[model samples]
Target: MDPKEIIARRVAKELSDGDLVNLGIGLPTLVANFIDPKIDVYLQSENGLIGLGPIPEKGQEDKNLTNAGGQYVTLKQGGMYFDSATSFGIIRGGHVNVTVLGALEVDSEGSLASWIIPKKLVPGMGGAMDLVVGAKKVIVATTHTNKGNPKIKTQCSLPLTAYKEVDLIVTELAVIEVKEDGLHLIERHPDTTIEEIINQTDAPLKYTNVKPMEVKS
Candidate 1:
């Protein structure tokens, strides 16, 4: 299975009924594909709308409405539209229960590096800054490493989306909780070893009553 699918499924399990969630543009966007059909998680978009549904079929695509990633999506029955600027009010006001975010790097303190990569060309910071701070719980879903170097590090060097705002992080081999001091290892994938996780990460990590993360086939 794809690593993203694993992360998506795991993120799905964190949801409760009636959550207002914002899925960051890339890999995090796949969370919509994994949510249980029975659970009604209210999806929100920063571009002035809430109650977003899943993507529509090719022919059903609508040019007017789409997610931040520009993918066409459906809407819930009572969903409404407003000005994009006002949407930040909902984000900063703490109405969202959880946010699934994609990150370039996450530091021991939960600082995120998503907006810029100084030397390399990067796009806008988007709503990451607001979601990290405003959402009650922040969940980061990304690969353990990029180019074989760990993306979860001791301190973030790229940039900051928000400091110490992240709650949990899910990588291909590990599931960690971001804390004030550093990461607390909660679980490891079946074939993964603690040594392997440490060797790949650029930062030090701590263990927190850890056990293996299991999945039901």
Candidate 2:
């Protein structure tokens, strides 16, 4: 399976039934496509959407219906739209259950730095700060490395979006839980080994009952 798909699939398992999930742009959005149909997971978009469905079929795209990332999406049967204020209210008022976000870098302390790369021009930080602080749980869905460089570091060098706000980190190589002590390696990708994961990650990882992730093809 594709690495991104693997990461998305693993992240999808983190959701529980009746979760009001806010999926960040990029890889995080792919989680919607992998959610179990039997579960009641309502995908939320910071741009004012609830009950978000998977990506629309190529020809069925509705220009007016887009997620926060501007990707065309289909709304579920009971989905509804609202203004940005109400949408943010849902986030800030602690209505969101889980928020899955992608990160440029995450630290051992569970701090997130995903908004900017300093010199590069990029979109301004959207609702990430609010979502991280407000959501009941925050999961970061990102690759373990970037162009051979480990993204999980001892401390984030970039401007942080939230401090010690991340609860979990799901990568193509492993599933890590962020605890008060530090990053915990709970599961490794079936195709990877502990040595490989340790060598690729910059941050130190503690292990307890580590198992292979159950990734579907």
Q: Report, for all candidates in order, the number of backbone clashes.
A: 0, 0
Off by over 4 Å in 2: none
- The positional error of residue 173 in candidate 2, measured at the CA in angstroms, is 0.7
Candidate 1 local lDDT, 66-152, one digit each (tens):
877787888889898888777998988998899889888998888888888887857878888998999999999998899798898
Give candidate 2's error at residue 72 in angstroms: 2.0
- How does each model score on lDDT? 0.85, 0.92
RMSD of each: 1.5, 1.3
Best by TM-score: 2
Residue 174 C-alpha lDDT in model 1: 84
For candidate 2, give the lDDT: 0.92
